[model samples]
Target: MRGGPPQAEQPDDGEGQAVLGTGPSSLYAHIVNKDDIDGLLIGRLCAQIVLPEPDPDAWQDQIRDVCAQLRDQYLKYPGVFRAALAMMPTNLDTLRVNEGLLAILLSGGIAPRTAAWAIDTLSLYVGAYALERSLLVQRQRREGDDWVLSRDDLVGRFEALPSDRFPQIRQHAGELTAGSGHDRFDFALGLIIGNLAHA
Candidate 1:
């Protein structure tokens, strides 16, 4: 699947947005199983599978029927347990290396368990992604202010962090939050897609 630049975005992707109008990253949120194909496609590459390629009308009808049923459940009982696959976050570095990797994995006929395991391994990205988004939102809000990040500002006044108990935190303070937002994400994604080899 590793080929070229990432393709088109899903038109309806903006719907799965968080309550705070925050965007969900490429991270999967457990709604990709049999009953929720449409849900999986929200921010993930699964959306580009092109289900309607054959009989566009039929494809649209089927997709709509599925989405409608899902939407109905939400209206009838908000926050109900809807079925989904809940894939683990896979190595994204490979994806950035080759956008087509997503399509390959989707069609590869790999065991679902293995797929899930791989996804789980990439789960580390979720936290970094969330933090980056929060930072961006705050930065946008305080855009005009001359925000100088000094060491004092960096090390927020701690009230007994128990460094003796958690030595790693005390030792690698900067490494914990070293890179720029983009750099951090890129680094995490590098691990995600890092193991790809041309077939």
Candidate 2:
């Protein structure tokens, strides 16, 4: 994906070039418009997602699972997450996903406004994570064998921070950098879900 200012309008023809050996004009023969492409791709993304049946008892766990699944789904499609940032769900698959999330929240006795806000918040979190990951992927592709920074280098810098000025950061230097992407994602997801449950 091409990275630029947020307002940039970039055309993505990489898929067409890879598959058809041509530009998007050839791709357009199949997809009526850009919205059609978004729907088709997102539909495939949501196809296998199994939303838990409505159960107030299991709502928290079920919603957690569903949110995790949605985040993973967004990351699965290499560059499609960016579309999610701009477009609302119009297709059946995405609508079903939205319906399932709202149902779980409402069943748990969450206020209607809270449930509505949570959907938007959760979606934004997932999209932001996906965009960050995609940007890193692009950077790796561009850098190839050239290394950006080693783990040792990162740790060393963190450790060398002035303890007096950056006391908290210095104290938790290792903790700051420790954890895989999945670990951090799960941690944040749990916090969001837990806060929602309590709220």
Candidate 3:
């Protein structure tokens, strides 16, 4: 009964009943199935996001702000983004967020097709990032130690590789693994959004 991601293939009716303190009949009365529950949860999460008014002069910053907000919200629920992956943006709140992001991109003079694809790309990245973070936390908790490779350990491993066989990895191990907090996240988003200027 781990509360990580929702199991799309097999809905846990027992867990749902336990959480609601009701039997299957009682629980199913309000919700049709697990997919319905997932949709509702995702919708509620999306509803919490505060989309900023589009500013043509600062569309990039606005996009970053919205993405950061989404990352924060996704991290709050630890793996809830799995449900988002299982479905399209049929929920009103989810659609609202999508529309807001599209508006921001369009306000910056991005092409309509580019703006649409950007929204998909951003959403995918944010969800995948949060999902990975959640899984790492869960693994750490289960193992009773940090589950990720330490920077020093990673660097050492890279450095130990034969120079002829792995010249680049041995020479630039530190740079390869460099980043703390959300630095990589910011860098990746910057690459994506920065390219939109030409689009």
Candidate 4:
């Protein structure tokens, strides 16, 4: 998972050979094809996530911990989440993680349907966040060619927009570009999980 160009850029067979330290024939002997590899890789990643026991009183914190664990795992490999985007969670380990999250949500008093949807939403957000972060890291690593703008740069751009058309953006540019690290991630998770009691 750690070696290679981002997952988006690496060829499946090539990755398999490199990872397995074998030729294509040997790789095929163990797995059916690229899709199988994708499933297995994602399954392994899901298996690494630490799930908390269901606790009604601490459901919010439990949910946050689960999501943070997922985010940390995705961030480690820098683009491995792309596999998660392309496939459904058919792997046992992936389903285990989902079940664990659903249990926590349901314990919090969320309706069954709402809890299911919340899991979907949280998974989507985590995957997208990880993919975006991976791309940003890659761009920043390019020699003398960083594409991700600094918070100040983004704020300046927002403030430079036509004043009449973007009055709010100009006025609140600093706030708009305020967060560092995973602050925005935590705030977004709070918005999603904090409302579960009333959901």
Superposition error at 97 for model 4 (Å): 0.5
Instruction: For candidate 3, give the lDDT of residue 135.
Output: 81
TM-score of 3: 0.84
Clashing pairs in 4: none
Better of 1 and 2 by TM-score: 2
lDDT of 4: 0.81
Cα deviation of 34, candidate 1, in Å: 16
Error of 4 at 17 (Å): 7.0
| Candidate order (TM-score) | 4, 3, 2, 1
Task: Name model 1 segments beyond 4 Å from true.
Answer: 1-163, 195-199
Residues 140-175 of candidate 4 have per-residue lDDT tens digits of: 888887557888888889999999899999999998
lDDT per residue (tens digit) for residues 1-199 in model 1: 1233323332232433331143434422433332232333322332222332223224223333323333333222222112112323233422331233222333444344544444444332443344445455556579575463544455542212577786766666666656653566456545544432221
lDDT of 1: 0.37
| Candidate 2 weakest lDDT stretch, 10 residues | 1-10
Which stretches of candidate 2 lie above 4 Å from their native place?
A: 1-27, 30-32, 144-150
For each predicted model, how many residue pairs clash, with residues at least 3 apart or on different chains? 14, 0, 0, 0
Q: What is the TM-score of each candidate against the true structure?
A: 0.34, 0.79, 0.84, 0.85
Give the C-alpha miss distance for residue 180 in model 1, angstroms. Answer: 0.9
lDDT (Cα, 0-100) at 155 in candidate 2:
73
